[model samples]
Target chain A: MNRQELVNLIREKQSYLCVGLDTDIHKIPKHLLSHPDPIFAFNKAIIDATRDLCVAYKINTAFYECMGIRGWESLQRTVDYIPSGIFTIADAKRGDIGNTATQYAKTFFETYRFDAVTVAPYMGKDSVEPFLAFSEKWAIVLGLTSNEGSKDFQMQRVGEGYLYEKVLKTTMEWGTPDNLMFVIGATQTAQLGEIRKLVPHHFFLVPGVGAQGGSLKDISAVAMNADCGLLVNASRAVIYAGNGEDFAQDARRAAQEYQQEMAAYLAEKLAVKQ
Target chain B: MNRQELVNLIREKQSYLCVGLDTDIHKIPKHLLSHPDPIFAFNKAIIDATRDLCVAYKINTAFYECMGIRGWESLQRTVDYIPSGIFTIADAKRGDIGNTATQYAKTFFETYRFDAVTVAPYMGKDSVEPFLAFSEKWAIVLGLTSNEGSKDFQMQRVGEGYLYEKVLKTTMEWGTPDNLMFVIGATQTAQLGEIRKLVPHHFFLVPGVGAQGGSLKDISAVAMNADCGLLVNASRAVIYAGNGEDFAQDARRAAQEYQQEMAAYLAEKLAVKQ
Candidate 1:
């Protein structure tokens, strides 16, 4: 999905939740294990339960990749099953040399048909530029990540500012708000407002909200723009809310709760009408 | 393979050359496209011809990942085809949150069965440490990359030294030299000596030779340790040496050239008998 479509989605749904299918086979309800593809079955249920409540679906590629070829089949099915017009992100934190990045760009955008792919900016501009080349496809590069390890390099000072600050400022020069975005972890709410002001027009794919102990209210308060320039992701919180036969229903409840709260935030922050 | 096995392999072979199987479908000999699995067929020929010449085979996962499920099948087949003694690397460059990193480690080490997987260190210690969790497996984290874009973040000074240096030093606390390695690009010859001094025992997987314009002699002179701690990689130069019917033979000849140069460097730097 392009920038305008995504903004319209948040406006239309009054929610910017990107339900993550970071679906691990071991974590799913036991009853679904008998199915030919439990991962997809689980994801299908989650998508069905939450489709109307959210505007995006982010697939954690690692969860699928660890299963080998069968996992890929599950992934293919899951992506195909998601109702289109909603933004889709291949949360595959891929980065490499120039030519290699192009292949990754193809993997998510052309092959799997994700609307965006998460990229690591460690390899710098060329590593990220390939993902931005595709029209309507976005490259959501890592800014300040939620994990503690962000302190190791990203949070460290580079010249006058943090490495992530440098990342945000310099990376903005490479692409516009139309094709470029940043993955600003919800844990970095302290920096979120400044980050939003720093990169005013660009969107941010905000993870680390639900299961990772990040406050949804805090991040939304600081990061929302005129266009509701934030896609707050909640993975485990919604998908693994229940373990019984009513798991999908429980998931829907969890998603609706997030969407309801998000609607309130949208109305309060961007004056986005429900 | 563990550190000792890798060291012994380098010593026994009298070469630390890493044959990069960055097999691109469009670039492979058209005759091989008629095979049941063209990518695997091409990789098999290259492996058969260069088995004894190089101590490691680095598979650029992006090349295979772009082909979708069939690409993954080819990757499985090619890795299975490689001889047991040689180290195998999945040059995936994946990094994410702690749990996500664990899944990537499993993707390359457990599922794909590569001895080592290259990791991007942008997410910090939690991202890299999981790859080090597996016994006898390796996480070759990016220290400094070969691309011009490396100047963007990696070469930028952080605190007392470069960001990549902070990465090298801080990351050392998370894993032992036995399980840790760094991808030190050949283009950074000016820092090669200092980097070797900074990191004496750990191995460096050097890319950017040949097609990327890196000097084998320059890196070998400054970076070689007592154990000859370098696995210099030449991907396209070795894989696409010739695109005709005799491509494998051409590839073997290219690998032999790198091996021969590496053998001379091993003898000169480490004073090991070849």
Candidate 2:
């Protein structure tokens, strides 16, 4: 999960897809419910089906945490199950004061062993700096989120630019492209190019592509950098593609489609210096 | 708990003190390490000693989450161990996109049975609204943090006021006083009066009172309203007051001192309609 390694991942796979495992119990196939840990069994299937189709897996911690201790057990199993070569992200939007923030950093980076954990920048530098301290580990700070709530503060005027613009600019100073990335939503592709210009070298973990309805072609066209610095995440669109017994195969089909499309984008857009 | 219930608890106890359980294994007395669940054991002792001295207990989730599933077990036991009338807060500081935010709200409110969960407002209204959707549960949103990093985005100019000011103003619109509160850090007592004016009715969960160095006297003078609308939190200052065989007694003494000061404030400032 260093900068160079991520670059190599996209280049080697010809895909920058970061499949998001936002596995909710209520939404999963009923047959899997009888399994001791349905969340893990489902995730295991998804990872097995699509590991080669993507460069990374982003586990949305909220989904697991809702189930309480058992949910964490599921989360533990899922993170452990994901292959090491594929970069893993705990998309847990955690932020707090100094020492407490360090504990959160340890939760994801040390205990769960995720390559990166998404951080909220509202608390500012100290809340985020703890995540960047771990070598090769990453802190994907929220920039322009895909949700409707993004307009509430992110799009507001802050000095000369929008609040998210300030966030991207200010946060880059805290950590280099190696240990830091921004969660730039794909739904707001209008600002993607502007954001790309603002933080040229840093990777963007784009999360609005699939279920949230952002065209992958549009995002890949504008956002991909010389290093192929983009991790396009698809959560519900891929994982919940089908609810049948062959759900894993259905998920595989969806992932393969994304990978194939991303491969095309990689061919046209990626300009890695070999 | 509802606002009335919380107010009644404060009136009955004559203390707005929130004993923060930021229990770290390394910080706990070595004698407790022999226990099966040392974190829970330490927290039990502290709670047994100080349950009468405080109106609420804020479990800083980061401390428990760092230990993973076992850590969550400790959290479960500690929250369940607290007496029924005392308020419980999962100081998780979690925020995410809409549906995901609902999951976090469920994690803290439904699963954990916390009366309130601290939320970061960087994602805006939708992220915070779900936490308010619960009947009596509360969302304690971050307004002005205590750390030096608070100067970063929070203090920056946003239109006519600081970013944190806009956050306070805009976020209040999402939830009523019953289900919403703001974390107004105590160190910045200068802004307490101004923030009190901006957010008149809402309860403010004030940290930085003890270990982080904020005056309980100043915060109460400016921030206390008709309902004694403040929960002054002191984690390390109360929980880790001593590291010996009589640690619980020492914790009780520290908590008693805060409760004593708070009791006086409750008499002077708390002006209930009854």
Question: TM-score of A-chain in each prediction?
Answer: 0.98, 0.98
Candidate 1 lDDT for residue B1: 86
TM-score for all predictions?
0.98, 0.99
What is candidate 1's lDDT per residue for A113-171, written digit by digit as tens? 99999999998999999988999999999999998888888999887889999999999
Per-residue lDDT tens digits for candidate 2, residues A202-266, read 99999988789999999988888888889999999999999999999999999999999998888
Clash pairs detected, candidate 2: none
- Count steric clashes of candidate 1: 0
Screening candidate 1 with a backbone cut-off below 3 angstroms (N, C-alpha, C), the clashing residue pairs are none
Tens-place lDDT per residue, model 2, B132-182, is 899989999999999988998999899999999999999988888999999
